[model samples]
Target chain A: MARALAISAIVAVFLAAPFAAPSYYVGLLTKMLIYALFAMSLDLMIGYAGLASLGHAAFFGLGGYTMALLLMRAHASAWIAFPAGLVAATLGGAVFALLALRARGSYFLMITLALAQVVWGIAFGWRTLTGGDDGLPGIKRPVFLISFADQTPFYYLVATLVGLSALAMWAVTRSPYGLALRGIRDSETRMRAMGFNVWRHQFAAMAISAFFAGLAGCLFVYNNRFVSPDALHVVTSAEGLIMVIAGGAGTLFGPALGAGVIIFLEDFISSHTQRWLLVLGVIYVATTLFAPRGIVGLWTDFSTRKRKP
Target chain B: MAISTTLRRTLRAGLAAMVCAGLPLAGAGAQTKTPIKIGFIVPTTGGFAPSGEECVTGAKMYLESIHYEVAGRKIELIVEDSQGKPDVGLTKAQKLVERDGAQMIMGIVSSAVALAINDYARDKKVPFIITCDAGANELTMPGPLANPYLVRTSQNGRTPSAAAADFMVKKGWKNIAVLASDYAGGFDTIGGFADALCRLGGKVTQEQYPPLNTTDFGPYATNLDRKADAVAMFLPGGGGLRFIKQFVELGLKDKLPVMDIYAQSVYEPFLPQLGDSAIGIYSTLHYASPIKSPMNDAFVKAYFARVKHQPSDNAPDGWVGAKAFGDAAAAVGGNVENAPKFIEALKAVKFDSPKGPIALDKYGQVIQSMYVRQTEKAGDGYVNSVVATYPNIDQFWPLTFEQYESYKYRYAELKGSLTDCAKVLEKK
Candidate 1:
């Protein structure tokens, strides 16, 4: 009963958010939700699989620009383009996993970082195809037989997709697959000793993460109606990593809460100072020093500790 | 995915769609007649933070005169920083429309962000008056103007770069080499330079497109061994400034004359960064110190008084976009709730900007004058001194049906010869 009410309440809040919030805030929340999906996708690799991939935005933006380029050049329908984007992301992620995931820990991170930069350069240097730094502009929204060119419909479309993606992620986390994933996370050697195909499960989690990120990317391009090389930049992937870690790693709702906090902090600081980055650095540092478990982690720890008594 | 697994995913997707088919439309919600806010998205980080500050300052300056009201109703200015990144830009743009209650957006320094929001402005039915980042001639022609709510106050780099090439072509320079960053801005710079040189019967030895953050121009400098009459370049952002300094330090300036298309932040961002090394380089600009207009004098004075620095090309677009918008809002009796009415009013706008005689093109880009300015030391500081005025230099692409055919046939590098391109001219 509590779980159903919790899920229903989340859906209700999402559906009613735009009406109550200002347009900018609504847009902000939509982006938060979108990035939350991105962070969660990254967490599947970083948190569960223990493979730190900094090349996540390469998949995210490749999915975005791929969807963007196809939506315009191929005149693809959403049904066609969304899956095509996912497939493209999956292919790219598989190659990345093959190359970078073969390594462990810091070496994996470094390889992914280098690979992410290679893709970033391609986005910026391939002028004829990618529009270089100016980026691909004037991409149309998914018609979906209903003109999502309008704001409200587009927002709802994105919200619904985010909700479903979160639900799917939760479902995945509860299945037998989830138990195996946890086994890999807790101890990969233990899983391997138990005669499990540890590499395949890791690969499967990565593929799943890439698919959801690609879906989010598809929504992202539609949301902005444009894509640029900056999407492929390492900073963007880092942002998703920050969101997952800052909100509390290894939690279902952590990335979403982290995205929300970061976005609002950025918006609020930019309102007052031209030097908002300094403010962001300070905030992140303070959070790290004071609340080492992260905001949601702190709450969960406090609540669970109380419950234990 | 494996073939059968992919099939199953596809099949499940179809089933999920079927399950959600009865969802009610989310667009039926009505809008209120409250104050209309315009989201101003610009960079508040990177090397371009000053430009964003100027944009906000200019908008606020104009908004102050109107008492925060447009069309007899209240108006609000919502600000967001793109941080010069697309993903961040998209997020900020979303926040602008959905969180700030903005019906309009203005001020994007990076073309990337502007392009990203171009679709958003259309998707959300919001007006975005771009005050920075000159576009490619292609965008405003029969192309990207697909977004009706989009308008820009800056000319494409093609105009100024072409003019600089024209100046070089007229100089009868025999050989040329081009160096530009490997980006959209670089592509435009290269295109404009090559087009102009080819028109003047000059041949380019080779063109180099370097990475954005390249500090070492030594190899690029050494690559063009063959001597040319002049070297034309397009470098902007933090990269552009570094290139010019390095190019001069390598003694390339002494061998070949350098001309650039860096109007907005180049003057303020780069020139100041280089105290003396900035001398003798030529650039094309929409705003120069010697424009010789009463409106410009007032703006120049007011800017120096406020910011304690001479204004760059950035100041004019913000000032002009803000002033034109303010006038349009007043014309609508300060009521910005009726955005369509404000856009319509701005359509027929003929405001005397600090740059003088600013108006909108068919695509909502400003059809304004441009000038090729030379960098000269004036009282121990570098200033962009106007060398020649190409009053209303037609954007490399044409606006009217007649000019369109002419531009495609006569001028464009990929399409027509320089003579042929010149013949298709909209205005001289």
Candidate 2:
């Protein structure tokens, strides 16, 4: 009951965030929520299911452009478009998993990168469909009963969806299928011997992860009222990977909190100093050197150490 | 198209779900008929922010002069940062039109962004008053799908490039090497200059196309045919920031008088970045506030006061473009749908800009006076000192379709490509 109450309070604060904040703050929070949603999806794969996805933005962009092209050409509604986007992302994720399940470690990472690049090329080279390097413009986004006419309302809508998606992910991860996937991650060879089709479990993990990432992309488009080829670029993929690493990769809520704080810090720092990138690079290097387990892990260590003392 | 039952069910379900989710109905009523919103996308918050920042200031000054209110209606200039990316610019332009309720649009620094915006505006039916970005006249032209609302104030890549090249040609410089960025604007201006110089029987001894932000111009300078009579190049904004400074550092300024196609690329504001060495370079431009115009005098005084720095060739152009948009707004009397009438009024329009007189062509390109300016030291230290004026530079570049097609100039039917492009300028 206490946790449930805490969850509701979190949702309320997130929804009200942009309204009370300035435009830049609103934009930052909106991105944070979308990224948080994306991070949660990654946590399901990496944490619960034992699959790692570095090329997640491919799914994100797939979902983004699905909605983008639908509205750009066919005038599709966001209500209908978001799910279609999710399905598209899921299919993309499945294809990726099929290619990647045969490999492990560095090879898996390489295959994922190559696949994401292929998707990015499609977004870039196919100008007639995706506006090439230009990107799909004049896309009308659907919200829950009111079309998002501005950034603030869009923030609220995205915040709501992100929360719901997180809850959905939380529920799924706590279920038996999620447990089996986690078991597979812990010992894929053992799980295969235990009469479980480990490949299928990993595949399913990827599909579900892709769905939420795509949903995040869809909400991102809604928040920004724009989509670009930058959506599919490697830097974006790296950003998600960075968020996961910084927040403690295998922790469920950790990725979300990390995504939020990190993005907020980026927004604040970049705005304050143009050399924020240099500063961030220095800090990232320091963090890796001293606290390889990341912020949450380090905090946990501190609490345990203090209690022992 | 044949649809399966699942597809039909899904589409229908999606539609129903959207209704539940609250998709707003199209053609929604406006809050006010007379509230004018001008959506703008520029290279703000990036490497080009220096230029974008000045353009924004220049636009605001022009808008503020009229109090962002024209014909008793309030004006709202909603600006977005494109960050010098093409996709970002296009998406931002669309949002400004559809969501922010912007009636007209303006400003973009990169040629790639301008090209994207030019196509999008045609479908959206919002008047887009493009100011900067030197992508030639391939954006708008006369046709059924011609962007009726599209108007531009900035000069194209050809005018200045050709003028400088033609001057070099007149000076009997036979063998010239060329250097340009490989992108759309770069290619167009370089190609345009080459065409002009080559037509005058000059040989382009060597050509180099570098990436936009190549801080190292050592290879470019060393590799150049220093023996050539001249070296013509096209570069703008921050790209020009590094190219010329490094070229001079390599002692090319002493050996060869740089006949530059891109004048705005080398401005007075960024002179500090280039240092005292970046002087005496000759380039062609539409306006340099000291070019003997009442508007120029007023603009320079206002701009210098605002920036606390000497204004460059672009400051006047940005201010002039915003004023042109203001003129059209004043003529429209707050009905943006009547923009066709406003455009007709605009065709008949003559505004006192920093460049003297800005005349609209048959296409939207602004026909303006071009000045061959040499950088010099003054009380302000360094500026684009006007050498001579090539008055009323127009779109008709004395080139037949056959002549343009002789070289692989993108597409052959040059007239068909830039069918309706042009309008009038300031980058602001």
Candidate 1 chain B, poorest ten consecutive residues by summed lDDT: B410-419
Sliding window of 10 residues with minimal summed lDDT for model 2 chain B: B419-428
What docking tier does model 1 reach?
Answer: acceptable
RMSD of every prediction: 8.2, 10.9
- For model 1, how does the per-residue alpha-carbon lDDT over A8-100 read when each residue is reduced to its tens digit? 898898889767554555666667778888888887777667777788998898798788777777877778887889898888888887787
lDDT of candidate 1 over B39-153, digit per residue (tens): 7888877777887777777767667767887655567777777887765777677655654456678888877776666666666678778876646555555654467776777
Each model's DockQ score: 0.33, 0.05
DockQ of candidate 2 (2 decimals): 0.05
Q: In model 1, which runs have C-alpha deviations exceeding 4 angstroms?
A: A1-4, A15-26, A143-160, A268-275, B1-38, B61-76, B86-103, B123-125, B263-266, B335-341, B397-428
The docking quality of candidate 1, as DockQ, is 0.33
* Residue-level error in angstroms, candidate 2, position B7: 42
